[model samples]
Target: MTADTAKNFGPAFKTNWWARAGWLAGFLYAAYAANYLDVSWARFLQGLGNGAAFLAEMVPPNFSRWELLAANLIETVEIAIIASAFGILFSLPVGLLAARNLMPSWITWPFRAFIALCRSFHPVIFAILFVKAVGFGPLAGILTLIFASIGFIGKLFTEAIEEISLKPLEALRAAGAPFMSVIIYAVLPQVLNRFIGFSSYQLDANLRNSTMVGIVGAGGIGGTLFAAFQRFDYDFLAAILISIIALVMLSEFISTRIKRVFQ
Candidate 1:
């Protein structure tokens, strides 16, 4: 509207040649990959035909073996809850230590690196490693989800801590309050609600991952689902899929409620 405002705003769009070149490179690479992979229209149509036949086999779910399904579902829920509890406990101190605004460089560096290491691998990869290390059982799944939760929750917690107002902390220190006292009084009050929200979200994620880890013999409903696939029991597979969907939806409902209550 005004000359000064127009001058400050400059042009509506600013061209960055480097960003343009990067996008062009990405598009070129995608095209090259598609060509190399032989992704043709004919093959896509043929795959769709095959998928239609596969869906025909899955038409009425079989819940005849409800006992086994229930047991595995219970195990999956247990693994998620246990992993979430342990992950929350372990991440609390690690996250605090990794907050650069709150801790020294020497302390933050190691903790931050540890969090990065936890995040570097996918939960499936961690599950496979733990399966080999701990033998085939729920222990492996628990460990995988725990590390996954720590990576996610710890990183977010550190960021939240960093963004907190430092005035309360400064006042506490000036008043000769103990370090733990200062943290308990100042740092936590600002981030507790956010931490609860993060914990609930991580729990939901863990529930889904718990089912997947069982595919590698980590112990849950995924093992049953994999068996159904291997046996060509599409009806049973359909039942398991429905069950997993229900589990995820239920977890989502609970997570939303928790966030609302805390808010």
Candidate 2:
């Protein structure tokens, strides 16, 4: 190209005016929000000091109530396991029904809406409702996690089914296979690995959420932990926190192993 023609060309990099405006608007809105909330450097520094003091009080954690801790931990595990099983079992049919490629729009719509409803609220909110309805305990916790697992894994499961190659499904249908047989022979194999992965991940999530639901009286270690905090038993609270951390880590490790085995 001639030097004059090259010079007439615009710069290699062009500015995105819309993006710049969006960023500026976002920054201005953030500043406005901070101002509206009365956020200040003085309060921030005070919060830091209070946080440091709280950390100091958490040292040398106490686990004196080992019996109580063990009982609640067991309850949490039970809630997680039962909820995971129920979620996986129920999600399969609902997910299959929701898959647009498999089921008609008329059939998928209601199931899809149900899944959306399940996912609309946080687990804690569900726990609160269940606690009120059931009058508290592990049953409430289990029910809460079950719906949560359905909301999460069900959507993924539908996507997984939808994404499967249709050739195998068509071949099975052409070979005079029944719909159920096609699902068993053609659909399940294609999506089994993904389904297992989703279930394991959901189980891990249920375990973590199970601990928190107890705070709302759904039943678990969270209730004990909340009581400790209310009584200002920082050492006991520290122990409970540590135990929850350890439980979560252990669940993560187990989930990883399960995924590896499937892979």
Candidate 3:
């Protein structure tokens, strides 16, 4: 091979042994896990057959109890709205406080830790705890989702703040603007679009999650859906799934419009 060609292909800049080894290790681990878990083609085929049978049962969706279904769906939307509203509101300050670029470590650390703590638990667990505390209803679901939103929204907002350019901030400070003024003029302008996007996305997520929290009796459509499942009311369950699909699509349309307006 020519000298230049050899140089071009040399391991000095091209080698990434660590990465290759990591990939190999991951592949091996996945194979071992599958074997350990008894993941066989026969088992998979059996599962598929079972799933097909289930799907057959769910066909011909029944909305005979449309009144009850409608009430639960509305309650789910209400939970999502209330949770998203309060969560997004609270997340703003939490995000601001956690921004390492703007706040000192002492100030940022506690807030960051708190957000971390909020994120550590899954929404179902939070729903369970709140349900126990409040003794069932939409309030428990609302509280659960609020904490979930703060965790997700707070982290994203903190990251958005950290990614903002420091130039405007420096200029505003040089111009002797107060702390709040600096944030108002220099910070908000940059991240407002992203913040709105995050909030709307969280609202969308809360809507889906609200439906699930109800399974635990925290409120929404989940309890009804679960009961239907137990009673082998697969037709009704199918209707609920279709309604949820509609709800999500509606949210998606709204989110697109809101994003377009901001853009």
Which model scores highest in TM-score? 2
lDDT of 1 at 72: 94
RMSD, one per candidate, in order = 4.9, 2.7, 3.9
lDDT of 3 by residue, 1-263 (tens): 68888778775577789999999999999989999999988999999999999999999999999999999999999999999999999999999999999999999999999999889999999999999999899999999999999999999999999999999999999999999999999998999889999998999999989999998999999999999999999999999999999998999899889889888
Question: Candidate 2: global Cα-lDDT?
Answer: 0.94
Q: For model 1, what is the alpha-carbon lDDT of residue 150?
A: 94
In model 2, the worst 10-residue window by lDDT is: 3-12
Worst lDDT run of 10 residues, candidate 1, spans 4-13
TM-score of each: 0.90, 0.92, 0.87
Query: Clashes in model 3: which pairs?
Result: 214-223
Candidate 2 clashes: the total is: 0
lDDT (Cα, 0-100) at 254 in candidate 2: 91
Candidate with better lDDT, 1 vs 2? 1
lDDT of 2 by residue, 134-193 (tens): 988999999999999999999999999999999999999999999999999999999989
User: lDDT of candidate 3 vs native?
Assistant: 0.95
